[model samples]
Target: MPSPLRLHPDRLLPAEPGLRAIARELYAAVRELPILSPHGHVPAQLLVDDEPFRDPAALFVTPDHYVTRLLHADGVSLADLGVGRGPLTEPAARAVWRVLCERWPLFRGTPVRFWLDTELADIFGVTERPSAQNADALYDRVAERLAGADYRPRALFERFGIAFLATTDDPADDLAAHAALASDPTWTARVAPTFRPDRYLEPDRADWCKAVDHLGEVAGIETGDYAGYIAALEARRRYFVEHGAVSADHGHDDAVAEPLDARDAERIYRSAYAGQVTAAEALAFRRHMVVEMARMSCDDGLVMTLHPGSSRNHHAPSFHAYGPDTGSDIPRRTEYTTALRPLLERYGTHPGLHLVLFTLDETVWSRELAPLAGFYPSVYVGAPWWFLDAPDAITRFREAVTETAGFSRTSGFVDDTRAFCSIPARHDMARRLDAAYLARLVGEHRLDLDEALETAVDLVDGQPRRVFRL
Candidate 1:
């Protein structure tokens, strides 16, 4: 028989009796709050199409790099899991499920394990942990559920208790699906588009000029000159605002935001448009655009968010074979104090620009991010992201930043995920961890229980709304 699976009620609470009791009460109060996911990679079109998920492997293994990256480390090929291989037949998906079951021990202490355990036992009614023996049975159960109308995208979305969901979109996207959602009287829930203009901002990338041209065409503005390109971006942002977008997301390699003279900026833009810009010139141009994005944010009401310091697509071979966000990206050391001087000097105190900063580098919590948020009224520290969203890292994040910036100055939790099924489970884990943290503070006499409870509610709902200007 497969080992029985059970999620402890007080799993992530404090171990001590007094603190544990306090945490249980705190968790109970906010555990059922509606999730406000301000940033993630789940497409709005998923609900727009309202399609059933393909299969177990396609749903869990293929689209989720977090699962596949570890499985790949165990010598399983990406193709074996149906990644980049299109649809998976029952037999193919079952085989992949068996592989995951056999290698399930590889995820023993991972956040993936916690989420899957919650998903399996709570969401899918699975009574046992995944094992080689139970692979087929578990797959059958999940497949049965997926075939039902209750497990379809919209139904599952409502079941997850998500209050607001924001999806990332390119500058050239028409957002027809966004319009469809907004106009649908049946779906009165909040679904917002986020303007993501990464490709159009960086001049050194291989397809920068073509991306710029496409952005211009989408905005119906000419991009023959540098100023025209800026206008095109501005037009697209306005289009997003009209479509119900409240925030703009930027994920660059670094956070450098230096300004450049008009002549220098124009020269670099013209050279890049002609495919003649040098690497150094391209870097400078992108840095200027970083500040320009802030200036744009000040004029428009869109909240600006930046998450940098990931050395994306670290392996060229894997990138060429599969593509980006395949879990090939790794975090690097980041120093934000110097890198962000130019932008901060210009608009760090501006009331209109709400700058939310996220970092993959853990070392900057106290050294840079917290201190920066402490001083700048416009700045707010972002939630843990990617590699640092685990239990220990999150605990350390609170400890590291609270002294300088405090809880109110940080943006509420952002899932920042692509895996759709794991959304509620991930948010639940964060709530539990936060309760545990607050319980410790209460025990230490730093805060009253009433204060902790109020703050907890704010973190789960109010903070995201305020930080993102929702």
Candidate 2:
């Protein structure tokens, strides 16, 4: 007989029964709340086209680097797993599933295991444990369901209880898709874009000059000089605002920011354009641009989000084959105190600006991020992100920062996912973990149960919406 399938009644609850009950109650209150996904990489066209998802692999596996990377690490080839290659035929899907199921033991204690199990059992109603023998059957069942109308992107978005979803877009992007979705009266989904300008600003990026030229074309401004480049960026910011973008996103290897005079900035820009800048020059230019971007945000009234410490595209071969965001990116240690001093010193007191910071470096939670956010009028701490987007990390973040920065200083949970179906699962995990933590606080008499319940609700839904201005 097949082994029985079961899910923990209090999956992330405390070990004790009474506290588990409290956590369960708190989770129940916020579990059904609408998700406010202010930062994510889901394609805007999915919401624009309002089309049905093709299949299970397309929906669950192909776009998720977390799933694919784990499978890759376990000796499964990306091609055989139907990643970075082509569509998986039914037989190929079964093979991939069989391999994954046999290696399910690899994910035994991982958060990915929780997410996959939740997606399998809750989303697809698959009661059987995934294993080599049952893998093909489960794949067939999920594929059948995915072909149905109920599994379409828009329907699933509604079913997932996502009230707001924001997709990242380059500043040079025309955002015509966003415009199309906005004009469609039947589309009730509140989909918007976030401004991301890394390619145009970073001098070391391949085709930096080409990206700047594209920016000029989109913004209808000349890109012959530093002043014109700034003008082009400003124009794009205005266009992004018109198209319902409330936030601008920055992804950097470091949190470094610099203050430079016009002469020095212009000279650096010239070198950047000619591809003659040294590594130090490139970093300084990028740092100065952060300050420039912040000053622009103050005028444009767009929230600024900085995600630092990612050494993006760590694997050159995989990147060349599959392109960016294929799960090869790695995180490095980051410093915010000194790195962000120049930018903060200039705009730290700007009440009109909203600057949200995220780091993969957990070391900074108490030492740097919490203090900076606590002191700066414009600063707010982003959720525990990327490698740290797990239950333990979330709890640690609350514990580390709550005493100094407090709950209000941090932006509440944003799914920050490219996986659409995982949005609810991620949010559910966050809610359960947060509730469990708060229950512990109440148990210890550090916080009242009533206040904890209220705060739980705010953390789940209200805080993110308000912080990102959703």
Candidate 1: RMSD over Cα atoms? 0.8
Relative to the true structure, candidate 2 reaches a TM of 0.97
Per-residue lDDT, model 1, residue 33, is 94
In candidate 1 the C-alpha lDDT for residue 292 amounts to 93
Q: Whose TM-score is greatest here?
A: 1
* lDDT tens readout by residue for model 1, 1-470: 67999998888889999999999999998999999999998999999999998888877888898999999888998778777777878899899989988999999999999988998888789888899989999999999999999989999999999989999999899999999999899996788999998888888899998999999999999998999999999999999999999899989989999999999999999999999999999889988999999999999979999989989989888888888878688899887899999899999988889999999998999889999999999999999999999999999999999999999889999998889999999999999999999999999999999999998899998899899887
Q: Which candidate number would show the highest lDDT if scored against the true structure?
A: 1
Put down candidate 2 lDDT per residue, 81-153, tens digits, no spaces.
6777666676766676677777777887777888888888887888888777787777789988888888888
Candidate 1, residue 104: how far the Cα is off, in Å: 0.7
State candidate 1's TM-score: 0.99
- lDDT agreement of model 1 with the native: 0.91
